[model samples]
Target: MFISDAMAQAAGAAGGENVLMQFLPFILIIAVFYFLMIRPQQKRVKEHKNMVAALRRGDNVITSGGIVAKVSKVIDDNEIELEIASGVKVKVIKSTISTVVGKPAPANDTADKK
Candidate 1:
């Protein structure tokens, strides 16, 4: 006979090494994403939460809306009173505060004031 039978390729063992090797790139990608993106984002969120939690009176902050104000009073868990201008104030959500620009440093009585 001139035609020969086509033999099938041999299957790999079921030890799972081949499966792991096939998925190694995906696992690495996920790990890289976690380290490069997810972990840093979580860290930033934690830092932001801590910063917001530590917010108090006299802390100069910039709102996400680009308004510069001082924390005149922390009204409640979710709201704060901001002194946007002299004798002018406004209420805002706590998380809307973006950056604590100037934290009021404690005054040292021993130092001479010029």
Candidate 2:
């Protein structure tokens, strides 16, 4: 007798959210992760692959182990000969190279561009 019947009916009439609205935050999080993290990582891998493929004799490179050396020979698809010092060459796996420091000057270009 003390409680109103309308209040009980109003409580029962409330509805749950739609399925899409329930999952919207998860979808937004995945989209942000792809754009902010995954995409840039893919781009860096592509760039590193290109740089590794373009390696040739006489290009100075820094290895992943932090050794600075000149590429003396490209042995095959997977290896290169690096000259760490005069007459001190070592065979290094191509993927171990971290960065190409600089390309050597062309052999045929004798005239100074000054």
Candidate 3:
């Protein structure tokens, strides 16, 4: 008896449009994050996969665990032998390695043994 039915219907339609506009900024922010942040991280992971697969023996490397060791032996497609110390070696998986250290120098016999 107090409010008109036609006015109430018009107000409901306008409120729905306002609600959708309020959510537009949030959707745009999520799209920006996916392209700028998430996509680059995924690409980096794929490149790291290729790098690990190409590793070979004699390539000095540092592990993700922060242990720097030379590639003493490549055991298989997934495992490798790391020489952390003289006569002290350890087995590490390919994915564990992070960076390749400087390459070893070529051996040259210049000095005479005493």
Candidate 4:
């Protein structure tokens, strides 16, 4: 007595339209997240990678920990030595460097010639 042929036919007819309407908000939210959050974060990471890869000795830099220092030497593809004082130095991961604060002075041939 509870089952009806008309009720089954109506649900079948509305299934496609109703399913899309129900999930439309979910699709919109995902699109919003990708544009507003994911895209900018990915761009920043790319810039950071390029900056770290271009590090050279004598470039003054700031670390992620806020330590300001100069690059004394590039130890490898992933590490470097930072001189924070006349003699004090620290070995840090390249990725830990946040910004290049100073440019290395231009090379002077006369100084070396003397």
* Number of backbone collisions per candidate: 0, 0, 0, 0
* Per-model TM values vs. the true structure: 0.86, 0.82, 0.72, 0.81
lDDT of 3 by residue, 8-62 (tens): 8777777777988999999999999999999999999999898888788788999
lDDT of 4 by residue, 62-102 (tens): 99999999999999999999999999999999999999997
List lDDT for all candidates, in order. 0.91, 0.93, 0.88, 0.94
lDDT of 3 at 107: 72
lDDT tens digits, residues 49-89, model 1?
89999999999999999999999999998999999999999
| Models sorted by lDDT, best on top | 4, 2, 1, 3
Superposed Cα deviation of residue 50, candidate 3 (Å):
1.3
Off by over 4 Å in 4: 1-13, 107-114
Candidate 1 clashing pairs? none
Q: Kindly list the per-residue Cα lDDT of model 2 for residues 75-107, writing each as its tens digit.
A: 999999999999999999999999999999886
C-alpha lDDT (0 to 100) for residue 106 of candidate 4 = 100
In terms of lDDT, which candidate is stronger, 1 or 3? 1
Cα distance off (Å), candidate 1, residue 28? 0.4
**Candidate 1 lDDT (Cα, whole model)?**
0.91
